[model samples]
Target chain A: MKILVCVSKSPDTTSKIAFTDGNTKFDEAGVQWIINPYDEWYALVRAIELKEKDPATVIHLVTVGLPDCDPIIRKALALGGDEAIRVNTDSSDSYYIAAQIAEVAKKGAYDLIFTGKETIDYNGSSIGGMVAELVDAPYVSLATLFELNGTTASITREIEGGEEVCEVSLPVVVSCQKGISEQRIPNMRGIMAARTKPLQVVEPASIETLTSIVNYELPPAKAGVKLVSPDNVAELVRLLHEEAKAI
Target chain B: MSVLIFVDQTEGHIKKASFEALTYGAKVADQLGTTAEALVLGTVNDDLAALGKYGVKKVHQVANETLNHVDTQLYAKVIAEAVTASGANVVVFSHNQTGKAVSARVAARLKAGIVAGASSLPDTSNGFVVRKPVFSGKAYANVSINSPIKVISLNPNSYKTVAGEGTAEVVALNVAVDASKIKITAVNKVVGEVPLTEADIVVSGGRGLKGPENWGVLLDLAKELHAATACSRPVGDAHWRPHHEHVGQTGVQVAPNLYIALGISGAIQHLAGVNRSKVIVVINKDPEAPFFKAADYGIVGDLFEVVPKLTEEIRKMKASA
Candidate 1:
């Protein structure tokens, strides 16, 4: 089985967020980057688990970014990916990225494709569906559990108030979230092997950039908290009703 | 030039998020000097004409049983066809589960620029610019879509639903429905008084509550407020609460109107999921807990004592009001 796992780097969750260049770009001056948690902990780890069950299963990591994304892809490789592909481009538009991934998926003819539910930075949650549409494959988002049997895939996804169990044929796209797999750390041996694994770079497909960022702004800062004394519980309620109007 | 809002439904009932989308779409239509219409797939039990109260001019139905459950492939095809037939230049959706699953595919099919998690109406003064929360609500981005056709999915709870006195004309739309490639075997629904995503207010607890045995205090407060109950990651990890109730970076993200946290230390991961809420109240015994920094109102006291008194005060307030 050949599985293509999509990987990307995001600012570490603890990093302070700021924008640069007239608020049109994220400031990378002091930002620390990590493999997006959903991609690393759920999508990539689940692919590794599938490979462990069947040694013949091949996992290929694909990322769409500039060369700065190499270290992040290497970390994913260390986890268990057999090979990696980098679409040499720096674009944040979801359509452009999905189109590039679709081009790769078409050329590779993989049986399954995986992506995290959404990148933490953009939080769009649209890539998997867009990729599936471009590739003309069935897509499932927010998958919590996945199992493969022969040519069929059984997947469970979270809906509004419940879980939906679904079955689809091979060559399907899945966007994974938590509950799909646990986090894994790369060991010394795997890290060394990753250094030898092939890192292929390819040009991006020619796709029109659908959207552009005009500017960025920070959320309004909170007015300092109103510290209600523990003894005056009724005052808090009065404040909620009269001052904040939140109740 | 018309705005078409997709009304999401599950088992024939319209989702609360759909109402927000309708109101938003209507306002956008007013901005564009056009009419706002609604498109609903599958067999619906609700009064479709009454949706005009939210400002829609008409409600279009496809009335197919297969669409009762979401098939992303088929839904996208039908929605794309509907958009073309109706000549809708702008499409609106509530960025809920169904919207997240299907909107992008529809946009791809129609070759339109799409924005998910849109926080505000498009700024149409110069061009169509929409504002959306980025970095998990830590910041905002103004996005410009240059495509002739545009698709937008509004974030849940970001827009308020406004209903006025009006009735819409219900029309049946003719569209082709393709067979779905995926088959749903079972659905396990969580039994709760309020669905977490749609709740206006949420009451959450953490490991500081001690254990599952002491959850009654939280539940009682939630009941009085008519709010959904959620938990921090550790509480969900320890199985004190179901995994669905977990709200953090890797769990469910919520933007309720009011969020009350009891005993949570406000990890960054937890804050990412809920920083979008309009008002936050934190109650933790430790004065230095990180949650206090993000709270609009805070009380540095034991939740065991503070929660009951707060609940009682609210009950008395509600009783007299």
Candidate 2:
């Protein structure tokens, strides 16, 4: 089985979000970039699980970004992807990223495709569905767990009140979330093997832009805190009813 | 032209979010100078025609036993076909879990431009541009779709469903139902006293409640308000509450009108999920807790002292009302 895992590099969640160019663009200075946690922990780990089940199985990690993304791609390779593909293009809108992935996925003839539920940066879960649409395959999203045997795959996904169990044929796309698999750390052997693994960079296919960010702005700063004495419970209630209007 | 709205139903009952979607679709139809129609799959006990109170002119009933359960792949095919057959240029869905899956697939099948988690009506001012939350709830983005057909998934609790007096014309669609290939193995429901997503007012306790034993005060407050109960990730991880009741970036997303946080520091991850709420109230012992920053109102006092008093006041207010 050939599986493709798509991931991105995003600012570590701890980074204090700031913007430059008069708040027109995100300030990347002094910020550490990490493999998007969702993609690495859930999506990539599950892909590794699939490969473990079949030694001959091949997993291709794909990302669209500058050459700097190669380290993150290599990190995913260490995590258990057999090979890596870097589309030599700075990641743009979700539409363009989906288009790039669809181009590679179509030619590779992957039986299954995997992606994190959403990138920490964009938080757009639209890519997997759009790629499924572009490739004309079934799309299942937010899968909590999945199992594959032969040509069929069964998935468990969380819904509003309960959960749904679904079965789909091969040649499908799934966006994974937590509960799919435990996060894996790369061992010494895997880390050494990843350096020797084949890493290919291909030109990006034509992408039609659909949307652009006009500007980026941080959320309004939180208001100052209020303190009330623990003994003054009635005062707190009064404030809630009159000032907070929350009672 | 017609507008097709996907009615979300479970266990033979339609969800409140679907009603908002139906109302939004009806308004979009009015904007286009067309009639709004509904497409229902499962067995709904409510009077379908009465949905016209929300501006639906017709409700297309597809009472197929196979559709009693939602299969997104199959439902996508059926809804896409319904849009084509009904000659509808616009398709609408509630941006909930089920709607999120099917809307994107239907849009792909129809090759229509799609927007999910829409907060308001289309621009309709000139071309079609829908505003949606981006980067969680921190910001907004406007997407323009020049395609002939448009698909929108409305965010729950974002729009109020306005009622107008009218009766809908019920029309049965004769589309062939395909037996689902997927089988439901087992359903493990959370069995909550109050489902968090559907709750109007939520009272959530965090690590600040100190320990599970002290949780009684929080539950008492929730009960007094007839509100649903929730917890932060740590509280749920500690088994103080069921995992399903955990709300944050990694758990369920909610947008209740009123969200009360007790003994919780507002982490960015937690804020991302509930920031869309209309009003937020934070109660904590420490005045400098981060949650107070995002709170519309904050009280600095020991929750043990303040929560019981607040509950008493609300109970008295309710009794007097």
> Top model by DockQ, which number?
1
Q: What DockQ results do all the predictions give, each relative to the true complex?
A: 0.82, 0.41
Per-residue C-alpha lDDT of model 2 across residues A1-247, encoded as one tens digit per residue = 9999998888776676677776556778988888887789888899888888888789998888889888888888889998888889974366678789889999899999998887766665667877887787777888888999798998988777666787778988998886788678899888899998998999989765555454554555556545556666566566666776656
Of candidate 1 chain A, the 10-residue stretch with the lowest lDDT total is: A90-99
After superposition, candidate 1 runs with Cα above 4 Å error = none
lDDT comparing candidate 2 with the true structure:
0.81
lDDT by residue for model 1 over B1-321, one digit each (tens)? 799999999988999999999999999999999999999999999999999999999999999888898989999998988898789999999999989979999988887888889999999998899999999989999999888999999999999999998999999988878888999999998876688888999999998899999999999999999999999999988999988899989999999999999999999999999999999999999999999999999999989999999999999999999
Candidate 1 residue pairs in backbone clash: none
| TM-score between model 1 and native | 0.99
**TM-scores, chain A, per candidate:** 0.98, 0.95
Task: Please give me the DockQ of candidate 1 compared with the native complex.
Answer: 0.82
N/CA/C clash count, model 1: 0
